[model samples]
Target chain A: MKLAHIQQILQAEVLTGAGSLDREVGMAFSADLISDILVMCKEHTLLLTGMTHIQIVKTAEICDLAAVVFVRGKRPGPEAIALAAQNDIPLLLSSLTMYESAGLLYCAGLPGISRNPDPCGRAKGERTG
Target chain B: MSEQAKPEQILILEFTLKSLDFMRAGEASSEFKQRLKKLGFKPELVRRAAIAAYEAEMNVIIHARKGVMRFEIAPARLLIVVEDEGPGISDIEQAMQEGFTTASAAIRELGFGAGMGLPNIKRCADAMDIQSIPGQGTRLQIIINNE
Candidate 1:
């Protein structure tokens, strides 16, 4: 799913990277813990979380995520917003709870990151796309 | 700085991991990922290196009082060594297991200390060597072969 689609589906407010709304997201993962996202999320994923800190932006960079969506109507501090802008990561805000946000995306056909091997037998976390 | 004949080398990056610095926990690892990308490493290798470095850096910031993380790059190998001068792990074997973390509730709230740090580092690196002394510190030497 494209980030723009996610924004529309969640009625999310763009907090940063207004220019990157069209970026493609290969997968989706939702977690409030930066480390969980860091360890479990794959590249080009739309990460949904309530963790509003610069480390979230930093985690997106490390994990090669597509963008971050702050769930439960949470908003990041100015420093985090600035960091996201500086790093060119799209940040969004949604009023939906984490469970609701993830459910909507999964119902929309966006898969989450999987630790299981791919159908093609590729190793775990390998990007099939 | 070496008088002896030495092969042409790449960059050596160093970063300090501050203890409980929640605001900037992943700073060094983020920069390390960029460096590997700018060097044109393969995407898989870059991701592995980035994950290793990030996990290792987080380990120090969460577990130690202070630490230094150094990256030594060469044509065929990338070496990352993080040394922390904080309380060391008493059970190295236990620490190497996934989901065996000793992180406080505060750290867990930040989405860390899930006991995945050392295990993930070991998974990402081609080879790893760890040295630790209870009440002293811990050191991790991680190598990922660029070739």
Candidate 2:
């Protein structure tokens, strides 16, 4: 999907890099954890998160992410926006919550980046389950 | 190899990773990327160098008390050396496990700590060498081929 398409679909505001809207996105991952993103995100993946930190932008840069969608109406601070702009990373703000935003994107054929199922079936937060 | 034939520009960055400075953690990596870009590295090589350097910088900040990152850039390759004085890993094998992490909740909240730092360094570097003592510190040497 292109950033323009995503902006239209989610009714998002493009905070920066409006010219790069036509960039291709091959996958999507909705998480705030940088490590999980590093491991799971593919090049050109659209990242959905509520966190408004500079690290998110840095993560996108490192992973070569296509765009970042700030779910739950979250707005990044000026410094964060500047960093995103500096990196040519398209930033979007949406009022939709994480689940709804992810669902909408998934329904539109943007699937989550799948990981190998953990044999232990341990959830994200459980320690030693 | 003649010293005169080697690339002339070498950039070195030294910073103190104050414990728990989440906001400033990835700053060095970002700078490293800029340096690589100025050096006119290939896109693929630049990406690998950025990932390895960024991950290593983050590790020093998240896991160690303090550290320094030195970048040696040449026409053929980039050498990155990161040294951190932290509670060294007792079990290197366990630390290498893909999903294992000792990062705290604060660190995880910032989107790191999925235990991929070391793995990322290994993945992005053409060669990686790690030396750590249980109580001393950890030193990581990574080289990314520029050709």
Candidate 3:
């Protein structure tokens, strides 16, 4: 689904990256834990998060996320907005709760991202650096 | 592509990170992502490299007194080394366990510290090496294959 459609569905206010509303995002994952987002999300996956910090923007940038939707009417500070703007990462504000937002988007044909478990589960790294 | 398919031109970049600096924590990783993209890495590989580097950087900012993130980019692989002068991990095995975090509540408030950082890095990188001296410091090495 295009970001524009998501904006319409959730009635979200676009805080940044209005120019890229046409970008299509097929999957999304919601989490307040930035670690979970980084661990689970795929490239171009939309992120629905309640946290409004610069780290969210940074996470989007590093993970190459499609965009970020701040749930529960949360609005990030100017610093985050500026960073998102600088990175061309769309930041949207939605008044809906995280669950509501996830449900609405999921019902609209946007699937949630599932982890691709490693064939050998829990592959351990070398102890020696 | 194999290592012999291209010449070894290791491009190096370094960035210093400060403790508790949430505002600037991911800058180095973002820059690394852009560099890899400009160097024509696939999006998936670039994202993995950037995410792994970002997690490593965050570990330093959240737990270390100070740290340096160094990147060595070659044609077939990228190596990220994060060295931090901080209270090193007492038990590397416990630290690598998912959902095992010793982060302060303040750091956790910023939507981090769910104990997934190192595990996430391990998942993203082709290989991860970690060495830590209790009460001294930790050195993390992550390598991501790029063809």
Candidate 4:
């Protein structure tokens, strides 16, 4: 899914890296735990999370995640925003909760971070990194 | 520097990890990540080295009073060593498990302590070793190959 499409679906506000809205968001991993995120997120996958801390950007940079969408309207702090901007990772703010953001993404043809298909029997899309 | 260095020289980057410094928790790893990227290690190797280094750094910051993290980049391998001065692990085996964290509720609030730190580091590293003395401290070493 394109990040622009994600913004449309979640009513997200792009906080940084606005130039890269056309960038393709590969997989989506919804989690608050950084460790689990590191384990599950592939390089360039989108991270949907509630934690709006500098460490999130650090983890995203390390994992090479495409972008981060902050759920529950949790705008990232100044340092976090600066770090993300410096690292060139897109940051988005959304009013939807984590569950809502994840569900909408799933229903909109976005696959989970896992390689396997979703359990709801939704046919998988063109899966590639 | 790469051209002038001796063939057997080990490029060691060192940093001190302060305890519970949430503000700068991931700084060391992020800096090291940039170093690897600048050095042009393959994407996968750079990622694995970064993740393993980050996890070890967090372990020291969260669990120990203070620690030293060393990142060594050789021609064919990457080595990470973190030695902390705090209450060490009683059982290395149990600590290595996937979900056996001892992090406090406060630490958990920051989205850490999923018990995946050590295991995830192990998964990324080509080899690893852990040593600890009760009431003293712990030392963790992990290595990843360039290939």
Question: For residues A79-105, what per-residue lDDT tens digits would candidate 2 score against the true structure?
Answer: 889989998999999999988888777
Q: Is candidate 2 or candidate 4 better by DockQ?
A: 4
Per-prediction CA RMSD (Å): 5.7, 7.6, 9.3, 3.8
Best by lDDT: 3
lDDT of each: 0.84, 0.81, 0.89, 0.87
Error of 1 at B117 (Å): 0.8
Which 10 consecutive positions of candidate 3 chain A have the poorest summed lDDT? Answer: A119-128
- Candidate 4 structure quality by residue, lDDT tens digits, A1-129: 899999999999999989989999877889889888878778989999999878899999889999999999998899899888998999999999999998888877788877445634644544343
lDDT of 4 at A117: 53
Candidate 2: residue B125 Cα off by (Å)? 1.7
- Pitting candidate 1 against candidate 3, the one with the higher DockQ is 3
Clashes of each: 0, 2, 0, 0
What is candidate 2's lDDT per residue for B1-147, written digit by digit as tens?
111223376555655666667678777777777777877887678777888888888888888888878777777778888888998888888997788999988788777888988887888889999889877789889998866
Q: Which number leads on TM-score?
A: 4
Off by over 4 Å in 3: A115-129, B1-7
Could you give candidate 3's per-residue lDDT for residues A42-107 as a string of tens digits?
Answer: 889999999998889988988889999999999999999999999889999999999999988876
Docking band of candidate 4: medium
Per-residue lDDT for B1-147 in model 4, tens only?
A: 111233575677788889999888888888878888887888888888888898999999899999988888786988888999999999999998999999999888989988999999889999999999989999899989877
Give the DockQ (2 decimals) of all models: 0.57, 0.46, 0.67, 0.73
By DockQ thresholds, what CAPRI class is model 3? medium
Q: Ignoring the other chain, what TM-score does chain B have in each prediction?
A: 0.93, 0.88, 0.94, 0.93
